[model samples]
Every structure is written in C-alpha cells, then in structure tokens.
Target: MASHLDLEEQEQLEQVKAFWKRWGNLITWVLTAALAAYAGWQGWNWYQRDQAAKAGAMYDEFQRAATAQDADKAAAAAGDLKARYPGTGYAAQAGLEVARLQLDKGKADEARQSLAWVAEQGSEPAYRDLARLRLAGLQLDAKAYDDAAKTLDAVKSPEFAGLVADRRGDALLLQGKHDAAKAEYQKALAAIDKTQDYRRIVEAKLATLGVPTVVEAAPNAGAVQ
Candidate 1:
C-alpha cells in the first residue's frame, strides 16, 4: 500500500510539472505586466501630488505679488504658472488675476488677451465660463459688439445662462436693436432666480427696454405648508 501511494504521488507531481511547463511563461509574463502597471500607477500618483504642490506654491507667489500690486512680479508668476502648470486650476486663476490687474492699469487689450487665454484653456468649467463672460464684457466696452455676441454664444454652462443672456442684451442694446435687447433681457429675467438680487438688475434692464416686469404673487399659504 505504501508503494502504491508513492506511485500515485509521483504521477501527481509529474502532472503538475507538465502543467507548469505549458503555462509558467505566460503566468510569469502576466504577473510581470501587472506589477509594472501597479508601479506605474503609484509613480503617476506621486508625480501628480508633486505637481500640485509646486503649482500651489507658485500660486501663492502670484497672490503675494498681486496683493502688493507689483504688476511685473505678478505677471511673471502668472506666466510661469501658465507655462509649467497649464493643466492646473492655479494657472487659470492666475490668468484671471492678471487680467484684472491689466484692466486696472488701463491695458484693455492686454486684459483681453489674458482673459482669452483663460477662456480658451482654463482647467475648470466655471473658470472658463467666467473668463468668457468677462472677455465679452471687455469686447462690449470696446464697441466690438459682434465679437461680444460671438463670445456670449460660446458660454454653455447653465449656471451662467442668465448672465450670458443679460450680456447679450447689453450688446444688442449697444447695436440699437431695442426689441432684440428687450427679448434677451426678458429671457434673462426668467432664467435668473427670483430670490437673488441679480434679477432686480435684470428687471431694471427690462424696464429700460420697455418691458414691464410682472410682480410675482405670494404663494398660497395652504399649499405645501
């Protein structure tokens, strides 16, 4: 019985050896690939953390220069953020700050350029939308009515929908299209939340355009109370 059991064990060992011989290379390759991928994923996470830290430091430098009103220093830091961390929110925010500084210095064209960069290449949707809105405002002030319209057309976020319509109304009014402007302002008024103060501004605009804003009636107290 011991000899029979030994023979069975030998046969089982031979079968395992044959199976390994057929599949060992593939298994080794798969494990090597998996380990390499895991290592790469870990390295990528480390690289992103390092990049964010560096970008945040540079953004701090920009804030300091901006607070000091040192235009040149602020511009330098903003440019650096743009060049090295274009994928970061810091770059877009720095660009916005630079645009504000430029506008404050009466450099309208320079401000437009900075805002255009942010509008086109910002890393966040809200930043891009804000840049576009500001750029459109600048364009409107410059009497580039058509350009302002074109810029407003690019604003797609629902959060900015009312503001975009309002700006479009301003552009139309500037072009002497009173009826079109009134329609746009009406749309703005409807899109804006009633509880917010901005709707008052829109309502005032509609009033100027000969559209009487309907005062909302009070909600019935029994309903949903």
Candidate 2:
C-alpha cells in the first residue's frame, strides 16, 4: 500500500513538472511585464510629485515679486515659469498674473505676449479660455475689431459662453454689424444666469440694441422658509 501511494505521488509530481515545462516561459514573461508596469507607474507618480513641488516653488517666487511691485523681478520669474514649467498649471497662472501687472504698468504689448502664451500653451482649458477672453479685450481696446471677434471665436468653455457671446457682440458692433451684434447680445442674454451681475450687463447691451429683456422678479422672502 505504501509503495502504491509513492507511485501515485511521483505520477502527480511528473504531471506538475510537465505543465510547468509547457507554460513556465509564458507565466514568467507575464509576471515580468506586470512588475515592470507597476514600477513604471510608481516612477511616474514620483516624477509628477517632484514636478509639482518645483513648479509650486517657482510660482510662489513669482507671487512674491508681484506683491513687492517689482515689475522686472516679476517679469523674470514669470518668464522662468513659462520656460521651465509650461506643462504645469503654475505656468498659466504666472502668465496671467504677469500679464495683469504688465497691463497695469501700461505695457500692453508685453501683456499681450503673456496672455497669448497662456492662451496657446496652457494645459488647462479654463485657463486658455480666460486668457483668450482677456486677449480679445485688449484687441477690442486697440480697435482691432476683426481680431477681437476671431479671438472670441476660440473661447469654447461652457462657463464663459455667455461672456464670449457678449464680447463677440461688442466686436461686431465695433465693426458696424449692428444686426449681427444684436443677435449675439440676445444669445448672451439668453445664456447668462439671472442672478449674475454680468447678466445685467448683457441685458443692457441688448437694451441698447433695441431688444427688450423681461427681468425675472425676486421671490418674496417671507413666502416660506
């Protein structure tokens, strides 16, 4: 009986060895690939953390320069951020901040360059959209009506849709397209939230174009609580 049991165990051991001989390479390869992938993912997580830390430091430096009203230092810091961290959100923010500073100091062309960088290179859609909006405003101020209209056309963020339409209307109006401007203003009025003060601006724009807007009345505060 012991001899028979030993024979059965030997046969099972042979079966397992045969199975390993057939599939060992495949199993080994699969495990190797999975381990490599996990390592790569971990490496990527570390790289991203390092990048964010460095970018945050640069952004803080830019903010400090800006706060001290040091235009040259702020511009330098912004340039460095743009050059080194264009892939990071801090670059877009620094671009916008420096652009604002430049504008306040009457450096319209420099501000335009900064805003254009944010509009074209920002990783975030919202940042690009905001940059485009401000850039279009600068174009409008310069009386580049066609350019302003074209710039506004590039703003596709849903949150800024109404504002874009309003700007488009202003551009068209400046270009003497009164009917088209009025239509754009109407779209702005339709899309803007009633509670927002910006909606009132759009309403006024529509009113100027002879389009009457029916204002929504405020609910009675004491009706229910």
Candidate 3:
C-alpha cells in the first residue's frame, strides 16, 4: 500500500510541474504588469496632491492681495497664479476677484481685459460664463452693441438664458431695433420664473412696449396648488 501511495503522489507532483512549466511565465508577466499599474496609480495620486498644494499656496497669496484692496498687487498675484496653475479652479476664481477689483476702481479697460482673459482661459465653465457676462456688460456700456450681443449669445447655461436674453434686448433697444427688442424681452419673460421679482421688471418692460401679455396657463387647468 505505501509503495502504491508513493507512486500516486509522484505522478501528481509531475502533473503540477508540467502545468507550471506551461503557465508560469504568463502568470509572472501578468502579476508584474498589475504591480506596475498599482505603483503608477499611487505615483499619479501623489503628483496631483503635490500640484494642488502648490497651487493652493499661490491662490492664498492672490486672495490676500485682493483682500488688502491693492488692485495692482491683486492683479499681479492673480496673473502669476493663473499662469502657473491655470488648471486649478482657484486660479479662475482669482481672475474673477481681480476683475471685480479692477471694475470697482473704474478701470473699465483693465477690467475688460481681465474679464476677457478669464472668459478665454478659465478651466471651469461657471467662471468662464461669469467672465463672458461681465465682458458683455462692459462691451454694451462701450456701445459695442453687436459685440455684446455676440458675447452674450455664447453663454450656454439655461439658468442664465433669461438674463442673457434681457441683455440682448437692451442691446437691440440701444440699436433702435424696437421690434426685435420686444421679441427678446418676451423670450426673457418666458424664461424667467413667474414668482421671481425680476419677472415683474420683464412684465413692466412688455407693458411699456404695449405687447400683449401671453402668460400660458399652467397644465392643471382647474386644480389649485
């Protein structure tokens, strides 16, 4: 019996060795690739954290300059942060802050330049949209009516659609296109929430133009809210 068991165990060991001989190199390569991938992921995570830390320090400098009401310093710091870390959200925020500071100092041209840069260079859509809106406002004030219209047209957020349309109406009104202005204003009114105070201003604009109110009734024709 011992001799028979020893022979069976030897045969099983030989089969295991044959299997390893066939697949050992393939399994070893697969495990090596997996380990390399995990190491690469850890390295990438470390790099991102380091980048964000550096960007944050630069952004803090920009914020401090802005808070001190030093427009030149704020602008300089913001520009540096933006140039060095344009991929950071903080950089875009700093741009907006700098633009606001420039505007408050009555530096329209400088503010417009700042806003234009933010509009063009911001990594985040929200900051870009805000910059575009302010830039359009500045253009409108400068009597660049068509340019303002074009800029506002690029703002894609539905939440800002009404305000953009309203600004377009103002531009059209300035250009003596009364009918077009009325249509744009109507679109603004339609886009705005009825309960919003701003809707009253739209209503008043439409009223002044003698355009008939076309408020569509809610779908629940007979039910009370």
Candidate 4:
C-alpha cells in the first residue's frame, strides 16, 4: 500500500509538471506585460504632474511681468510656457495675457498673431472660443468685416451664442447692412438671458438701430408667499 501511494504521488507531481510545461511561458509573459503597463501608467502620471507644476511656475512669472507692465518679459515667459506645456491651460491663459499686453502696447498685428495661435491650437475649447471672439473684435476694429464675420461664425460654444450674434451684428452694422445688423441684434436679444445686464445693452443697440423695444414682463411674485 505504501508503494502504491508513492506511485500515485509521483503521478500527481508529474501531472503538475506537465501543466507548467504547457503554460509557463505564456503566464510569465502575461504577468510581465501587466507589470510593465502598470509601471508605465505610474510614470506617465508622474510626468504630467511635474509638467503641470513647471507650467504653473512659468504662468506665475508671466502674471508678475504683466502686472509690472513689462511686455517683453511677459512675452518671454508666455513663450516658455507655450513651448514647454502647450497642452496645458496655463499655455492658453499665457497666450491671452501676452496678446493683451501686445494690444496695450498698440501692437495690433502682434496681438492678432498670438490670438490666432490660441484660436487654432488651444488645448481647451472654451479658450479657443474666447480667442476667436477676441480675434473677431480685433478684426472688426481693423475694418476687416468679412474676416470678423468668418471668425464669429467659427464660435461653436452655446454659452457664447448671444455674444457671437452681437458681434456679428456689429460687423454687419459696420458694413452698412443695417437691416441685417438689426436682425442679428434681435437674435442676440432673444438668445441673451433676461437676468444679464448685457441684455439691456443689446436692447439699447437695437433701439439705436430703430427697432422698437418690446418690454419684457416682470416675473410673478410667487402667489403672495
């Protein structure tokens, strides 16, 4: 009986060995891949955090230079941020700041260059929309009505719908398309929220264009509480 048990144990050991021989390499590779992927994910997260920290520091430098009214230093810091962290929000904000400083210095062409970059390549859609809006405004000021209309047409954010309409109205007004401008101002007024004071400004614009104002009714006072 002891000999028989030894023979059964040896058979079981051999069966185990056969299974390992069939699948050992595949199992080892699977585990190695999983470990490598986990390490890569960790390394990527660490790299992103480090990049963000560096970008934040550079943005602070930009803000300090802008506050001090040093356009050259601000532009340098902004350029550094854009070069090192173009995927970051800091880069987009830096572009806006640098463009503003350029505008303050009466460098309209330089401002347009910076704004065009943000409009085309910003990492965030909201920032891109803002860049387009500001770019349209600059084009309007430059009497590039066709370009301003095209830029305003590119704004896709619903939040800016009213503002886009208003700017489009301005472009049309400047092009001597009074009827089209009035229609756009009407659209702007319709899109704007009643709570926003900007609605009143739009209404005033419409009035200036000889569009009769329709008084909005006051809200009910909640049935005497």
Supply the TM-score for candidate 2. 0.89
lDDT per residue (tens digit) for residues 1-225 in model 1:
999999999999999999999999999999999999999999999998999999999999999999998877888899999999998999999999999998998889989999999999999989999999999999999999888888888888998999999999999899999999998898888888888899989988888777789766687945775
RMSD of each: 3.9, 3.9, 5.0, 3.6
Model 3: per-residue Cα lDDT over 162-218, one tens digit each? 888888888888888889999999999989988888987887877888887766878
- TM-scores of the models, in the order given: 0.89, 0.89, 0.78, 0.87
Show the colliding residue pairs in model 1: none
- lDDT by residue (tens digit), candidate 2, 132-220: 99999999999988788788889988999888988998888888899999999988877888888888888777788888887556888
Clashing pairs in 3: none
Candidate order by lDDT, decreasing, is 1, 4, 2, 3
Query: lDDT (CA) for every model shown?
Result: 0.93, 0.91, 0.88, 0.92
CA error at residue 220 for candidate 3, angstroms: 25
- For residue 126, model 1's alpha carbon misses the true position, in angstroms, by 1.7
RMSD of 1: 3.9
Candidate 4 C-alpha lDDT tens digits along 1-225: 999999999999999899999998999999999999999999999999999999999899999999999988988888888888999999999899899999999989988988998998898999999999999999999999889888888899999999999999998899899999999999999899989999988989899988877766678745576
How does candidate 4 score on lDDT?
0.92
Ranking 2 against 3 by lDDT, winner = 2
